[model samples]
Target: MNAKKHSTLDHALDNYSTADFLLSDHFVNHQLEPTPETALLWETWLAGNPPNRHEWDRAVYLLESIRLGLSHYAGQVISEEAIEALLARIRETNRQYSVPVRSIGRVRWMAAAVVLVLSGLLAYWWHGRHDSESYYAERMAGLQSKYTERVNRSRAVETIVLSDSSVVRLAPGSRISFNPSWDGASRVVYLSGEADFEVTRDIRKPFLVYANEVVTRVLGTQFTVRAFDAEGKVLVNVKSGQVSVSKDDVPEKGNVQDASGLLLLPNQQAVFSRRSEEFSKSIVSEPRVIGVENEMPSFEYDAVPVTRVIGDLEKAYGISILYNREQLKNCELSASLKTETFEEKLRVICTTINADYQKLDGQVVIHGGECR
Candidate 1:
């Protein structure tokens, strides 16, 4: 809020992804488990800058997709050529996620590498027709508007079940107002403060949350959105599935519906930058597996290639493992561990393999000597 805080934030964001966002430690932390401090930091960043939200969302989806795709090879021995081939496959998959031939006719990517159309462009496109603001706002206007608004002024989280059975855990001091339009056209809610949503999947109707200018849209997923007015920021953290985020601006040119805005995957967070009117993506401060039911392992590797060990670790925790395969390809490890934490697992692995792993700019990065 102060000039100093804004200046510090700008510097951090400016240097944000000085390397690839996917490769950064921020991504790694979010991929693993983000601490409350980390989540708040990102929330502050996103809620401050609104314009950059879309980019953050798309990157989250892409990064998570790539990580999942790579996890399939956990049991296999990865050679240099095999790794290259896998990278090629990743590229191909990315192309698939991108816009294909613009089915809407007027909505085409401005650049080949641009993952999602910016909300500015989308605002322009949607301002003409299919204006979600006018459509939903008009629908909610006058006595004809039928909506339910809930405000939580108490000290405990309020769990509210919507008409469609979608559940929202409204944080204390937060408010959420929604229309029982499930049988109608769109399921939209206006939110303030922070709340976690366990949204029921509805193919026919998409769940949309509007807080200030930031919009978080999803079909069915578990995620948290923080958009407190006093904070001057909007933030979305996806626990499962993908969530779309956009600013409230309706530009005069491009179609808003045509723009993807931000597409967020599990463990990723998007910060809306009000200072610069841009959205930035970061990993949650502490990211845990979406479902706690997944069996956490007591890993034991015997004379296995370092790659295999790392691969198994990645799979076990559902997080990305970045390492210098050239340095570790020939190395082998023999370790028996039980009741160790995720970090402890890595520490033992690294010790046995003569490697060092750490959170590098929010990613798990490892480097070490050859075992041979």
Candidate 2:
């Protein structure tokens, strides 16, 4: 097959007109998948002082722009047929504008024009296939009437301090909108993308973060909310204090009370699926100590029963660890676990006592055989 392609390329170079090579499969294949043989052949041809060298350069530029435009904007592979169609469109456009296709000075302008045209078409198709407006745009539009918006367009994280002293670290490409003045009822902020929030304590006005389809309500806490518009699920991970995550459409009857939602404590996470509109609770990937550093629990257990060790871990991390007392009563461990992580401590104890642990509904459950 490579030999046949090489033959075809040789024939095109020898007999075909300068611009006619643009339509040859050899040129398209070379542009798409360049091999050493094809590169050498093209270099040799260019070295022969072809009169249409400018046209060749222009063609390469145009083809590269088309490939890049389609890949970046449409996220699709460029087919040979699509390239042919695009070439035809460029010719038609050049003819429509009464410009020569091989104009050296206009090559860059033409390539840019083609890219813009392709970008516009991709945008139109994307909007037609999906929602007319992006999830972020739709949510922002809904709040435009009553809120002030801030967008983080930079590559680095942006810090936004609200009037209530709540600090929001907005991720790049994310945006948030909030009422300029709180009405003493509730402080609400709508988010699109990910953000880490350190909300100030306010018993009177609860802080709420509305992201995508889920609403996260907290009085005063530090947490991270990951709710990108294009993602299939929304995530709320509590770092300190507590938060209630619920569907945005669900009405809250009383103060900070969600009709149906998951209450996430420190080191807990809630994953809300957009398709099913359901939530699944789980422990965060890395659970940290909940309280102040000075009050950190001593994990150095010396000949202590497994139950007492588990109790200390549960209290330190503010997570429940369930195990059968009768089964693990005889299990004893003597290890200095102060340096181990929450999971490492659990693993060390469980492994010593022939037990296995699993996380279910944001809590750790242990399954172990009777210790002799």
Best by TM-score: 2
RMSD of each: 18.1, 17.3
Best model per lDDT: 2
Provide the TM-score for each candidate, comma-separated.
0.55, 0.63
Candidate 2 shows a clash count of: 0
In the range 1-372, model 1's lDDT, one tens digit per residue, is 211332112333333321133323343345335576665555445544534456556556454333333332333544557745754554554344333232312332322233223323323433443433342343335323466778898999999999889999999988777767554556777776799999999877788777756778788999999876433347888888888788766422212366546767677688775434568765565565453454644467678787887776665555567988887878887777555655666778777777765453234667675676
Give the alpha carbon lDDT tens digit for every residue of 1-372 in model 2. Answer: 222343323433334332333444566567667776776566545534345466665555445545544543443555657765765665554334433323334553554465556645644554455443456566655553667889999999999999888999999989898887886489988788899999999988889888877888999999999986544568899999999988877423323363589999999999886645789898886799987778776777778888888888988999998889998888788999988888788779878998777777889888874567
lDDT of 1 at 146: 65
Judged by whole-model lDDT over C-alpha atoms, candidate 2 comes out at 0.72
lDDT for residue 89 in candidate 1, whole number 0-100: 53
Question: Total clashing residue pairs per candidate?
Answer: 43, 0
